[model samples]
Target chain A: MKVVVDGMGGDNAPYAIVEGAVQAQKEYGIEIVITGPEDLIQKELDKYDYDKSKISILHASEVIGTNEHPAMAIRRKKDSSINKALNLVKNGEADAIISAGSTGAFLTGATLIIGRIKGVLRPALAPIMPGKNGPFMLIDCGANVDCKPKNLEQFALMGKAYFETVMQVNNPSVGLINIGSEEEKGNELTKEAHKLLKEAPINFAGNVEPRDIPLGNVNVLVCDGFVGNTVLKTIEGVAGNIFSVLKEEIYSSFKTKIGGMLLKSVFSKFKKDYDYKEYGGAGFLGVKSICVKAHGSSDAKALKNAIRQAKVFYDNRVIETITEYIENSIADNDENIKAE
Target chain B: MKVVVDGMGGDNAPYAIVEGAVQAQKEYGIEIVITGPEDLIQKELDKYDYDKSKISILHASEVIGTNEHPAMAIRRKKDSSINKALNLVKNGEADAIISAGSTGAFLTGATLIIGRIKGVLRPALAPIMPGKNGPFMLIDCGANVDCKPKNLEQFALMGKAYFETVMQVNNPSVGLINIGSEEEKGNELTKEAHKLLKEAPINFAGNVEPRDIPLGNVNVLVCDGFVGNTVLKTIEGVAGNIFSVLKEEIYSSFKTKIGGMLLKSVFSKFKKDYDYKEYGGAGFLGVKSICVKAHGSSDAKALKNAIRQAKVFYDNRVIETITEYIENSIADNDENIKAE
Candidate 1:
């Protein structure tokens, strides 16, 4: 299978993106199409030796920066790296697409260009994050801020299908993020969504409190984009604050400095485990084709992993599974409504 | 000034509650009334030697539990320690009330029994939490789950008043907690609330993203109870997970153990600074009288700090100031409606 890569995306740009594309193509045995200015991409690719036939360059003249308006940029920058890469997947020239570019621009381009699955209501940004027990998926991290109950129901189904296929967890348990653990607790959206989730065809673990999210009790956590975004950012904020505090304390005195020196390996390992780069990227689930948005600051290793993630998404037919799930669930709901 | 303490509250009750009361009375020179079974409270109070005239006991046989429904328990358990303590404030027998009991019960009792201030829309739980730079107040942490835009506007006002009077910050900045920083970048509720906040009398700092919360950018962060609760708990969950992971890494090997031992003091100090006990307790804003809800598992030190917070609230006439602010804002809103 062939996967398209945005060669002029992220902080490391052409060098890291080219290297990662080459690494992924060699290791995963997938054809890679890099999109950007041809000369710069070729210069970066020349630094590495790879199978010439497996890696090809598709030159795109323009680039989308993070600061530009997402929808407006996607509409205007037709020749941008992100736009070109998405078009490849849309036209069936590539099986999947990976970009470490502006998340908003990438998501907007993918949805507006490639389109959504037949039965899907909305595409969600599902990020696999490290938890106390293992990793879990937080769906609708920031895709749609204002959501209806139907939207959250779709998020749960999409999150479950994506987690089970990409993460390889069978019949993954899905939990609705709420302020309280009871079914009756939550605002109007979550309260109604909780009922729908209980009736959905997935393992519906009831309401999950925010305090229990880090424990990794469920494989998939579903919520509206507003709440999901807040939770995701709050976790990052708290972790960043704690690490900063720990660093200050460790360097405050001579005794702590020696202690920090001795535990250097331990700290490095812990940081590696919690790093966003290790998780590759967040998948824009419900899109017609596989689309992955890597972190904006991703390095070569992160981009490589993101390509691997895209390969898995394409191979497992995650989009088809989500479509089937949504179609069947919607049919059943229609039948229930008719009966009532 | 006189402060009433719920002697039968919290996990370490009447021992911790009684001791904390005596400590507050001795340190702050405020008259303290401990409400619970007279015999049990007296037994705990006997351990401390202090001014006899400054402390007294109020006999209340029943007790409200954390497991009980907040509103129902408040109505039925009239003689409970929490109920009696709230009544003392309602009747003007006490200047303020401190409870380490069930948060829900205390908040409900305070609002239902003591009543809300004139022109107050709703009472809110405002907690002072440790941030990177200093402490910040998260208003409506878990009071009203489903809130209108007006409720959030009032929360910003009450939060500003509380922070200024008790924390002694002059005209503290109030920020609306949202997924994005832009005024137009939130859900319907936040979008409308943003407009109202900008027009409100408080020092509106526009929208603050969740990622910037721990940086202490705003003195008061306002949101609906559902979002506020989730943000507060997510911070706790992430911090707890990080510390647990760090502990596991530090204990995994012999070298790390030596490092951990040497850094024990630094770790202890960091933990102490981040502890909830250091900040005292959350205040129930908009209540007619001062009402502070200490953490459920509060120790004597925590409870004493809660009493200290109540004393500050009483001395600063926070309720009076909030009432005036709400009344003026409501009048201005009415006038605006008329002009339109």
Candidate 2:
């Protein structure tokens, strides 16, 4: 299997990207194609020793910055690293593509360039976040801002498919995120989506409130992008705030400072549980191929893990499974609509 | 000024509620009317060493539960403590009402009985949560399941009025909670609300992403109830999960257990900062009369603080200010529409 890596993306750019790609090639034994300015990528590649034949470089002169309009930049900057890497996947030169760049640009480039799966309304940005028991999937995290009930129902299905196939969970539970867990609760979109999700062919776990998300009661949590983004960011904000508070409190006195020293490893482990690097990257499900968007500040370890995540997603044929399931469900719904 | 207290509300009920009322009367020198079974309220009041003349009992035989339908229950159970308390405010027997009862029932009773301020489309549940710098208000948290652009615009105005009056923040910054900060970002409702808020007479901070909420960048965060509720609950969930995780980690080893003991005070101080009692209760803004809903599990301290909050709200004439602001804005819009 082959994977295309964006070599000039993210904060750590060429160094972390080149090193991660080399590690993935050596450990996973996958053919790797790094896309960027060839000279820049080569300079970083020279710092690491690896199998030469297993990795190749593709030159792309332009780059997409964080401030640019995502869709417009993707269309205009065809020679950008993200676009070149996507082209490799489109032309069957690679089975999957990974980038740790501007999330908006990567999402736009992947959707418009790689295209959507048949019968899919819109692709979802599915990120796996740490929960009490384990990690759970949050689907449609800032992909389609305004979504109809149908979009959320499909997000539940796509999320379910991704969880079961890639995470290898059996009959993963799917939940519709809402203000309340009662059937009649939530906004119009969630109320309608709840009804549709109950009838979808998956392990529907009723409505899940945001308070219960961290408890890991459900494997797949589905919502429109606006609500999903709010939940995701709030979780992040709270964790960060708590850590900052802890850092200050832990140094307030001599006794507390000594206590903090003794519990240093404990805090480290706790922080690791909530780290984004541990999960690698978020997957853009309902697309034609495997596409993963890593965190913009991802280090070498995170990028390497993202490449592994992409390879696993490709190996499991997740895209084909989602396509088949969604097509069948759409057809069934169409027939039901006709009869009604 | 007189404040009505729901003695038969919340988990702690007559004991905590009655004691809180007695404490408020003693500290603030405000007349307190407790609503519940006369005999039950009197028994709790007798346990407290306080002046009898400052406290009075209004008989309420029934209690609305968390499971009951809010609007329907409020209409049917006329003698319920929540309904009677709201009736006191509506009847001009009390300047404000404080309840730790079912949030849904309290919101329903307040809107149906006390009514909305003239020209206000909907009342909002605005809660003050602890942030890094201090506390910021989150408006419309589970009050209205769905909201239009106009409703959010009004929420922003109401939130601004509350923060400036009760919190005494001068020209408090108001932010429209959205997935992104860009002008074109967010769903249709927020996109339109953004435009309306920009033109509204307030310190509009444009779009504030959820991540910035904990950083206390804005004094007031406004969103549709669904998104607001999700953000509120997610922050609670994250804090709870982190504490649970920390408990496990701190007890994971003998050395860490010793560390935990030494650092207990630091942890306690940190927890106190985020405690619900510190901020009193949530304000039901845009109503004709002041209505404050404390946490359901509030103890005496929280309930007492909630009463103090109601008194401050009443003293500042917050209701009158909001009424005047909303009425003027509505008139200006109607005139603008006529000209167009």
Best by DockQ: 2
lDDT of 2 by residue, A110-129 (tens): 88889999989999999999
Off by over 4 Å in 1: B338-340
Looking at model 2, residue A195 earns an lDDT score of 91
DockQ value for model 1: 0.79
lDDT of 1 by residue, A1-340 (tens): 9999999999999899999999998899999999999999999999999889999999999999987889999999999999999999999999989999888899888889999888787899999998888899999999888788888899999988888888889999999999888777788889999988898898999999999999998999998888899999998888777778889989989999999999999888777767888999999999999899898888999999999999888888898889999899889988999999
Superposed Cα deviation of residue B144, candidate 1 (Å) = 1.8
> Poorest 10 consecutive residues of model 1 chain B by lDDT?
B266-275
True contacts kept of 2: 0.88
lDDT of 2 by residue, B119-194 (tens): 8999999999888886899998989988989999899889888888988999999999988888888899999999
TM (chain A) per model: 0.97, 0.98
The candidates' DockQ values read: 0.79, 0.84
* CAPRI verdict (incorrect, acceptable, medium, high) for model 2: high
